[model samples]
Target: MRIVLVLEYDGSNYCGWQSQSESCAIQDAVEKALSAIAKEDIRIVTAGRTDAGVHAFYQVVHFDTLTSRPLSAWVRGVNAFLPEDISILWAGEVPDDFHARYSAVERRYLYFLLNQSARPGVHHNKVGWFHVPLELETMQAAGKLLVGEHDFSSFRAAECQAKSPVRTITHLNIVRQGNLVVFDLRANSFLHHMVRNIIGCLVYIGKGKYSADWIDELLQHKNRTFAAPTFSAAGLYLAGVRYDPSWLIPEFSDFPIISNGVLR
Candidate 1:
């Protein structure tokens, strides 16, 4: 049977989603719990791999197993052995051909920035902070330029191994609520550090360090050197993944609720 799982985790404690030899990765923790339950080693694949300090509200993964267990076992059973910071939200059987990563049509990410002079206290390490006041109107204008298919080399990390710099941003929006600024981005796929890099540039634009048109110029340049530095990984969240209807994955619409009871 092929099992699919929706996971929610506070990535602040782990070394990212992929299992590493160091045994500190989220995948290692999850696989350990699963293996203990199945009494067999289990390998899993995820929809997307988030970097260190990044959180995930709905990360999807699938694994094949010959052992037969109730669906609830995959949820309640596996979660029993996992740490409090990681959780298995939903679990179900998927078709043999369904792949968590390849089958995903679009992925969504949300970035939260505390845009006040005062440093975040309770929310520290959970959100990005910018001391200077931000100009939301200018940032919104700059963000609009990133929507659509484009070669996003400027926003990609130097270590990114993707074959191409081209990716399509189907949706991009920037909005401000009180002292919090939210960046909601949806794309077919993302390069390493892509969202953070873009957010750094947006921050610069918001602070009047760059003009609104600077994003367009950066996109046209296609040079990583010309873009703003990568923003903090603390602010990024793997919001959700969208797959074809045939996959029958559960639909989740609510944004992640963090410790402060703020919805991102």
Candidate 2:
């Protein structure tokens, strides 16, 4: 019984949340919808790993079952056998040292940027990287010089395997709306693609083309070619995963799948 899942997908049809070897992933479509609702075989474990086309609104996973269903049969039996861009926005029973990726302490990400100049007829594939005319207060003052603790080897990912590129960045906002420019990171951990190479150098420092002192000389030169091009994962999102309140559970944030994706 370990259970804990919250998922929401549509990374434009898979190949992201881990488990790959040639595409088609979302952990192999939520482990084949939790192995057809616990008929057996299940293997889930996440709280991170979102690459190919990246997207999630509150991804978290965990597994271990012996049947006994109910939690609304693991959320209406894994959203009735998953598919239409994945669903299953809830499930419970956690705390055996709860860990949807090492008892995650913090991890949030938002990275969107739709500058405007037309081209988002209908939320254009969930927003991000539309370019032209960005200067939301100098991209929010270079995202407040990348808030807090750092070592982010120039925004990581050059085959990042993360054994330490150091990290802390508690938050880094950069907001805007008409033509959207979002950004919203938060961290305690992150390496691979590190928020799309720190929004490709915060969109080259919000389009004056780099210089918040080139992010303190690329974090004092840890290097990744001083970063500036890993932006569009179609507006990345995984937006949540902070655990520690005795690994919460009772009315876990008033449940509704813990406000699943914060109201879309």
Candidate 3:
């Protein structure tokens, strides 16, 4: 049977989502736990792969196992074998035809930028910090230019393996809540480092280094070198992924990470 699981994790501890040969990745930890529970080899597929130091609010993965255990065993039992930084939120059995990555219709990422003079103390790796006071309205204006479908090559990473640089960004909004600058982005999909690269450009604009028109120029150029450097991954999150309701994946918005980052 095919099992789908929603996971929440503090990526601060592991080496991204993909398993490494040394087994230091979040995927390695998860597979290890699943293997212990199923008493068999277990490999899983994810909806998306997050980079090192990136967190996930609702990461979806699926694995096929002949060991027929209850869904609760997948959640509570598997979590027992996993470390404190990772937890399985929900598990459901799905049709064998369902795929975690291919079936995804949209992906959303949230970048939490702590805009303050002093660095974060307790929330060290939990946020990206810009010491300078940023202009919210200016960043908001620049962010709007990036909305809609376009070639996002400028915002892609050099090592990105995506076959096409074209992506349709359905939403891009930057809002400030107190001292926190929240960047919310939704796209059919994103190239590697796309959100972080775009965040860096928006931060440059927010700090008076560039104007809103710079985004348009970058988009027209379709060159990665023309854009700002990729921002820190510490603040990035694979916040959510959407699939067809017919798949019957359970909702997990009740998790605080889904509502907002550490600070809410």
lDDT of 2 at 128: 72
Model 3's TM-score against the true structure: 0.97
- Residue-level lDDT of model 3, residues 125-207, one tens digit each, is 98999999999999988988888988999999999999999999898888888889999999999999999999999999999
Instruction: Kindly provide the TM-score of model 2 when superposed on the true structure, using C-alpha atoms.
Output: 0.37
Poorest lDDT segment (10 consecutive residues) of candidate 2: 255-264
lDDT of 1 by residue, 1-264 (tens): 999999899999988888888998999999999999988999999999999899988899999999999999999999999999998988999889999999999998989999999999999878999999999999999999999999999999999999999999999888787999989999999999999999999999999999999999999999999999999988888988998887889765643354333473
Record all residue pairs in model 2 with backbone atoms less than 3 Å apart, i.e. clashing: none
On a 0 to 1 TM-score scale, where does candidate 1 land against the true structure?
0.96
TM-score of each: 0.96, 0.37, 0.97
Overall lDDT per candidate, in order of appearance: 0.91, 0.76, 0.91
- The residue pairs that clash in candidate 1, if any, are none
Give the better candidate number (2 or 3) by lDDT. Answer: 3
Q: How far is candidate 2 from the true structure (C-alpha RMSD, Å)?
A: 14.8
